[model samples]
Target: MGPRKITAHGDKGAEVQGKIRRLGSWRRAAAMIVAVGTVWAGTVMPASADTDLPEYLTKMRAPEMWKVADGTGITVAVIDSGVKDLPELEGRVLPGVSFMEPPVSRPEEKYPVHDDFEGHGTSMIAAIVGDGSGGGPHGLAPGAKVMPIRTSIGSPMAFGAIGEAGKGVRYAADNGAKIINLSIGGWWSLDRIGPAIEYAQSKGVLVFVGMGNDGSKMSNPIAALPGAFGVGAVDINGEPLESSSNGSATDFAAFGGKVPIRCKKNTAWCMQDGGTSYATSLASASAALVWSAHPDWTANQVARVLLQTAGGPVDGAKRNDWVGYGIARPSKVLIDRQGDPGAPDTDPLASPTPQPSTPSADPAAAVPPQAESTAAESDRSWKWPALGAAVAVILGLGITGILKRRRR
Candidate 1:
């Protein structure tokens, strides 16, 4: 969660402001920010340098977290570039599938899940439930499993791939994956995206998707449907990331700020790396911890607990558009002995946005600005409201997420 400090955007008690201050009642009502222009102490910061979370390596509250989520027994499907299997992750990660096609194959590395050009996915998996075998990253839920589902490929802007990323979403849900983490994005789709999201929610899987880093362009799909939780990125200081993206699509902003990432597949000692992708992975792992602790709870209840207990100012309780329910404080859930898991049959979100129109394929479909010049509202909108998992052989999305076809 970003600092619950004061801000210039809205009132003091505004949901955003309250989150800045938090429950303990900050010393002064003053909202503070770091030199870099992002959210700091509840205020819009001025542009500055890298904003990573501060190092506070505390002892594991529940050392047993590893026993539950080695990511071996429970499957956590990661839909992104690919897993390159590093030394620390040896024997931990599943063999996994790739969407990179034949010519471009999974990176040739040793460990278990150490593949990726972006390095975001690897870092996230580590945070959620790192093996910690060789003193590697230990995940919040160590006893869980890891599921890798590769979707879409390419570099920065001009990236393109199979149009059907939805397939991956479905596959994850259909499979037995309990958690889905999506760190990727594209334009919104009511037709292609909506129904698939509904499927995941129905399956009782928790989906944690990143609200794009392009706050000025796209919209967030945190919980595309109710019950789902969207996650935003924050720095080590508990503030928002300059490029982490924001708006209503966010349900829970996370620690996406600047942090040193370990080396990728071949080498170690990574220099520069961090993004909402990694944060989402951490959020997914955090969810795993909550789920592991309360195995019987449905995805909705787990999600609600995380949001309800998330650190925030009691004065402003409404969910925000950009930062959604606020920062995800799984620690709160771990300590809340009396927390309710919520009803199993009911949905979390009050209303799911109607599906968006698709292209020429469907008879009732509208042209839709699929090629529109505008960026996705979830990504660029100033406010956001919303939420992922993976599948197996078919390589669907994380929660019963979007299931796109693998390219030939």
Candidate 2:
């Protein structure tokens, strides 16, 4: 069984402040280019021109993993801002489709499929499959190819296009993409993308999503979904990042604190940034490595191995809201030969069904017979309050106004 769900603890004022800070960063990026739940920490400050392999690669033991598998035959579709053809990712990014029109500011460009104005998707691509040419950041799985899918999420708009994001997920599934990396999330519900994620799962594709950076008690909609593997962020010490979101939806954690990335304003140097987006990318690359090594393994088996090999929570729980199965350790499977491949069709992370309860036969019960309730009744009892709490959290996040505006 998965670990029991735990309630998140933090200062309410601090959470609100963090949410404001996160929204401010998104708006700033949107000013230059559009954004969805890109989960970028924004270049806080410049770092030395040290373009060495990121600490995360070492943490995940990517070098050791590469000795066994480098994801040579796998394709990870990045569904977000388009990917740029940087030297680090040259010949690795496929010519992906764009569901949105070209940026109004860049009409001269016929195809915005490769235009990464926000630089979010480009960084994500480099994080997944960069070859480290010209002293750029080295990706975790350098042999994996990236498929870029452009959408309004990367545009200079305010709100995200949920419908377009859904379409992008479906497109990646229909294409040759074996893994779809959706490092995007939002304050609003992701109901629109549910069916598309389901479609991908049906096609033997694994989808990885980022748990947002608002420091909220619950994960964003994308991560909250079942078919998607929700990823959170951890620092070098393997502790959850301070800004990382947590909830029942979080599936795993990865190095997301101050990892190396090509500076957005200047590609000549590398800078340190952090976010759940990077964590998601690293998790997706970890899956790619395992998938490449075991090409014949079904998606379910690959997922099961990941769950089996993951590091347990610090509290000794089977899982937790903050880190889910725990930190991703692909090297365990690649080098140590750990984790069971398990059944080909069973999803290791699937929620367990609650067994029905039967009435006690003892006549010495002190409570009246009318006090007895069926299991379904007990289940329904918590449903409304849980839902009400969720709604309250959304309203507190200022999403109610957005929903009302959209309805208009």
Candidate 3:
């Protein structure tokens, strides 16, 4: 995640800051945004007579690679907060659905969609496929279309949140979305969402998830879910940010810090937005670019190529804890023609086969009589602390916003 200081409105600032502090170390894990006037290192593009690319784009060589693949004919599903009708995303976003209603709902009313309440989803959508009109930052996959699915106004942590996320995944898969970008996550299990993830995988949909901003820990549940590609954040210099979460589940890293984002209210752009959320969007767009160029390739093949060609340290490690396979280098696959698109049907994750869990016929066979005393002892001491942390982060943080005007 990017470095940001939370500034609540008016008198609520102290209360919000106090609550944020109660989250303990998790406060540092919250998704971050750049303050309005901050300038990150290696992000100042030279002024030119012609339009100059955003620093992150130029560093990633997006323009040079655009000639090879621009994510044409691809649809990326952004399942987060609602996506607004931002000028940059005017024609690229498709009509989507909302899962924010109560569990028991009557069929009389229509749920709202395509209206971003917190402005997080719109920023994410812009990162994936904004057309860069009005001198806005160009998305990695400007030619790709986006399907905006509203799961929550802020974080996707409402009641039955997992079920809503599962439903969103299914909807995207059914609607011909090639890539599903989940920029929000929590510390929940995958049990509720497993079937939906399987459904997407079966439909050849590549699902990319944010690895969270919790450094050095694999805390977020979505990152551990099989078939979900966990993305981490890196700086313009291709180094993993210290705040970026790290674990075995982290699949790849992409430029997240100092990336340009559309502002929440005005038409101006912000250059300081960052976190695994933005990185996930870029990775999703990269997948779209590869898949669009190789129309014949299956999701598995595209995923394989991305992993194979990703750039990393000279040590030659297959995967690192912070960056996984390493920073996503779509240029290597698209322009350099590196990496082989392996077998289409074979799963790149290669998850282990599940074994049946048939129980014994005996009534008392599951537990030993001697361990009954210990089994009844409940040690839930961590719940209250963890819940407090979760609440603080869920209420305060989100995808970082964009800033600044393009230089010419």
Sequence-dependent TM-score of model 2? 0.74
Looking at model 3, residue 260 earns an lDDT score of: 60
Error of 1 at 356 (Å): 31
Which segments of model 3 are wrong by more than 4 Å?
1-50, 102-111, 153-160, 262-268, 351-408
Per-residue error (Å), model 2, residue 5: 6.6
Q: How would the candidate models be sorted by lDDT, starting from the highest? A: 2, 3, 1
What lDDT tens digits, residue by residue, belong to model 2 across residues 371-395?
Answer: 2111111110001123323442343
For 1-408, candidate 3 gives per-residue lDDT tens digits of 332222211232242233223333544442221110111222332223225566777766788778988888999998876777766788788888887554344546444777565566777888888777655557889889999888643432343344567788999999989999987665322344555776788898998888765454533445555467778787666666655665555677887777665453433455554677788999999999999899999998898888777765334445555666667778778887888776778876563211111223312111111111111111211011344345535643331111010000
Candidate 2 structure lDDT: 0.64
Of models 1 and 2, which has the larger lDDT? 2
Error of 1 at 143 (Å): 2.1
Which prediction has the highest TM-score against the true structure? 2
RMSD, candidate 3, Å: 16.0
- Reference-based lDDT, each prediction: 0.47, 0.64, 0.62
Worst 10 residues of 2 by lDDT: 375-384
